[model samples]
Target: GDQSWTCFLSADNFKGPIAYYIPETWSKIGKLFNYPFLYGRGLDARPGIMGGGAMEINTVPCFEATDAQGRVYSRIPKLQFPVDAQGRAYLVQDVAYYSKAALYDAVKSWRDGGPACSGRFNENGCFKPKLNTRTTRYSQAGKRIAGVERFFDTRIFEGNVWGLQWFTNDRSETGVFPRYFKDEGEERVVAAEAEVPAETNLLVQNFKLAKQGAPYTSPTVGAWANPGPKLGPFNVKLADGSVVTYSWYRFIDQPSFQQYRWSEEKKAKLQAFVEKLHASWSIDRDYMPPPTRGRLVALDPALLVTPPKGLEVGYVPIVTGQAAQ
Candidate 1:
């Protein structure tokens, strides 16, 4: 089945500062697999409908998860974390597609109302009442344009303080993983650190396996000077019968930066900055404003965490990618 190949589509007019699959393509892929986990990104150089028709959209039997809850949390055992037959796990772009769809649907509903205005606008005294009137086009361009605006509403870009996206001196960071949640309602739980292979790191091990002998430098995962308040001990059992462990670390506290080649002084400075944030910011408070147009899904109460002591809360982080991060 071409299910082994995965493809991404991005467009300028489309939603988000993030990449989004065009509606037609998303519908096609959705029909193939409600929660599809492909082995690799097809063949890199091949070019066609889907990277040179690598996807067997019609013939492959659609795969489904047995767990009722597992269906919504697509990044769990069956979908996002699967190890291919070759024993490789690729980095997943852990966005909650279901939540994304819900956002799309909300915009559609709003547009169906046939609103006159395209988006939220401010007037400096010369406002007309007809500007807020309903029109049939709202179901068409109104919805489409509104959806695009809703997607990029967040401050999830570099240089923004307290948004989903963050940036360092060298790079910009985003995507779901190392998410925080309440102990009882946490969307997904991973393995304990002790269960995984102590000698081999998951990021490094998986990086080499995925690279398949390509000439690439091994990446590093750094450690925090004062590791505090985290969740996990959650585990993912690989196809090779090995288990990998992960946890939910604060956005800044996560080991993502360590994967790069940075000077010790730089690392220490970042860690110090993280420590300062940890002391000041509570995870429970909302740093970014709520979405004005469409409903933002997956900010579930069940997934709510009672910020432990000094720690507080913010965005509902859902990891849609592989554990290699």
Candidate 2:
């Protein structure tokens, strides 16, 4: 809980052609359109320092999902980042949570078809129809929908950015980490905020393992900072006055690592396909600027401590059979 999250927004929101408010994904006619990792694309892709020579940069919207009784069960994509479209940069979808494996596979296949996938958008109707240029996935009441699991599926991590590795948890379709991390302890509150200085180099730390470098961000709206495939407990910041502070909270899914030998031809084709996707470009004149920083105070440092300072550290006493060796 002592760790931190990260987020990055473009410099053009205040000066761009349009502004995109991510909570509703393009709610304004003049704002750049944005979507969380769960839905899909809004602005056109530009360029960045990561994947595709571009990256997503923006403030993330946090929407809570709940059931009939108003019991919160799942929250969709938690963050978003931006990419360049033509010569301009725009926020794109970059993160998501898979509450159920069945639903996850279904939705993923519907949007991004690939290995083991069997669904697609127009054919399955998994998504609600888009209402307007600034609208997508609205409820019957026509309000934006979020805060509950309409379908069943295992929770999953769907974003990859920076030069991070991938990892996964083998939880059953009914369970997920981070989403479930809170269940194991008391509630987590946004205890405090630290004002970030502008113009700083960014780096992140994935808690489960040791690695340091620029951290990964979601390509969609509403994402927190994390080490994409590796998972996190991370910290981020802006070092100069040119930009304020950016932070994001990220969860990880580390799959078992291994090597599968591939022949030259197969590897070459795969690499080329990926390259082509990265090369496509456009100019998304619309963009959303991040809200200015209001609070720069550091989080309550007291929250970072373990063992309650003077109390004895808790440890399980392991029993040794026969005191051997």
Candidate 3:
């Protein structure tokens, strides 16, 4: 079997961003892949199409912010957090493909003032501005763009914001792999293409043929159970026809914690408190605290002072010598 490499395609006029992979390198791979069909279906029937060579397209909405001064800023929404193979986290922005100047102007428009105008028309019937607020306008898709729940936060850039294609978000999920849910009224997962890699790798890495004398236990009940040693090595074929072998025991336990045993009501309260604390911080402030005197000085909200039943909270406050007076 010939190996195939999956590739993603993006264009402004695409109804759903189309993706196709090169199943056979020689069968019009270069021509079909590089065809410039701006606003029409492409390669409907082509040779060497493996499994139809077409994939489900995922769309991300593009946004434009305009001010009363006729200045406009545009951006394509992006995912902030995506982890790598080695478990290192990195910030990832969806493909913007905007020129440096355009990106900077867009960010600047959102930061200085929003896209709304606060002034009234003058005697000449010309629109005059007492103030200009940048207003956001979405593409034809309306509010829900790219599965993003909220509009882009200009404050994420802080004061030193630039036109670069990269940024960060504190609200992003912590792992490289995202969690998926079953589709409504369907037992199958919604995004099989995205989940297949993670699910397959997880099964390969965790398959245990024998049970240990005692299952590894954690301090908290209902934590993930460790099923001792794995049976043997697992092999997966890569896109380039390379078979990579992975041993189960080679996978080490990454740092993790079980949720504190709290009632649903208490958990809701704690979540609300944390949200409020986050809101209290200045938007421009980075979520990560700067180290002071070789110590990380983090704010522990007063709501966390009392522990829930069967749980305890601990911290040591770093006091400055000057504050002692």
Q: Compose the digit string of candidate 1's lDDT tens values, residues 1-325.
A: 1111222222222212112222234334544676443323222212224121111122211111222332211111111232334322232111221221223333333434532322111122121121111111111111121221111112322221212222221111122222111111322222223323333333232211233232222122225322421654344545533434444556444443333455767556544544443444343433223333323344323323334443343211222123332
Per-residue CA lDDT of model 2 for 1-325, tens digit only, reads 1111112123321122111222222222223433244232222221112222232333323233333443332222322222233211122232222122423344344334454332111223222221112111223122333321221111211232222111232321212112211011223211101211111111121124323434333332222211222222233222321211222111111111012233656545534433332233111222222223222234333222222222211111111111111
Best by lDDT: 1
Worst 10 residues of 3 by lDDT: 316-325
How far is 100's C-alpha from truth in model 2 (Å)? Answer: 17
True-structure lDDT of candidate 3: 0.28
Ranking by TM-score: 1, 2, 3
The 0-to-1 C-alpha lDDT of every candidate, in the order given, reads 0.29, 0.24, 0.28
Better of 2 and 3 by TM-score: 2
Each model's backbone clash number: 19, 77, 10
Task: Please give the distance, in angstroms, between residue 234's alpha carbon in candidate 3 and its true position after superposition.
Answer: 40
Model 3 off-target regions past 4 Å? 1-155, 160-177, 185-325
Winner on lDDT (2 vs 3): 3
Candidate numbers, best lDDT first, in rank order: 1, 3, 2
Candidate 1 local lDDT, residue 277: 35
RMSD of 1: 25.1
TM-score of 2: 0.17
